[model samples]
Target: MSARLEVRLDDERKQRLEQLGEAEGVPISEVVRRLIDDAWEEVMRARRIAAVERMAQLEVEDPPDPETLSRELEETYGPGGLS
Candidate 1:
């Protein structure tokens, strides 16, 4: 399903978007969709980075030992399960 949105852009911005669409051989709506998708991807990437940063700040008790993890993985999967 698709949703419809009516945005009111300034003349200059609308003209710029129109020109960009023309140059790219696509409709202005397509241009706007691409811009919105790119912005959404960047926002998701930033959120992932923030999550990693938060996890790094937390202290974990008895995190598994790397050697033990590797050995368990090797037994389950194959030798050098994860090199």
Candidate 2:
């Protein structure tokens, strides 16, 4: 399915979009869509990084034994899996 979006861009931004589209041999709409997708990916990547940092900073009570974790890793994935 296809959808339509109507957007109003300032003259400068509209010109830039037109220039970019011309340089890429595509329509301004395509350029805008690509820019939107790129921006979305950047935002998602930042969120993922923040989540990982938060998880790293978390303190877990009653943490598992190192030996037990190693054994489990080895059993699940064979030798060198502990790394």
Candidate 3:
């Protein structure tokens, strides 16, 4: 569900938005919603990218090698290890 929003813009901005909406064959509100949604999507994408990069950094700081892990497990438990 969505609620109605009433915003007051300067005359020049309102006219420009109206003109753009007309050229795009859509309502001014739709044009504004599209612009806002696009900006929000970009922000979210950047945040996700930053989170992935942070996770990569953390992984590099505490890395686990498969070969060393296998050898340690075999030495501790048995030849077949946990399997």
Q: Which prediction has the highest TM-score against the true structure?
A: 3
TM-score for candidate 1: 0.69
* Model 3 per-residue lDDT tens digits across residues 1-83: 88899999999999999999999999999999999999999999999999999988774555469898888899999899987
For each candidate, the alpha-carbon lDDT, in order, equals: 0.94, 0.93, 0.92
Error of 3 at 83 (Å): 6.7
Better of 1 and 2 by TM-score: 2
lDDT of 2: 0.93
lDDT string for model 1 (1-83, tens) is 88999999999999999999999999999999999999999999999999999999989887579988888899988895766
Candidate structures ordered by lDDT, highest first: 1, 2, 3
Per-model RMSD to reference: 7.7, 7.7, 2.6
Q: Which stretches of candidate 1 lie over 4 Å from their true place?
A: 62-83
Badly placed stretches (over 4 Å) of model 2 are: 61-83
Please give each candidate's TM-score. Answer: 0.69, 0.71, 0.74
Steric clash count of candidate 3: 0
TM-score ranking from best to worst? 3, 2, 1
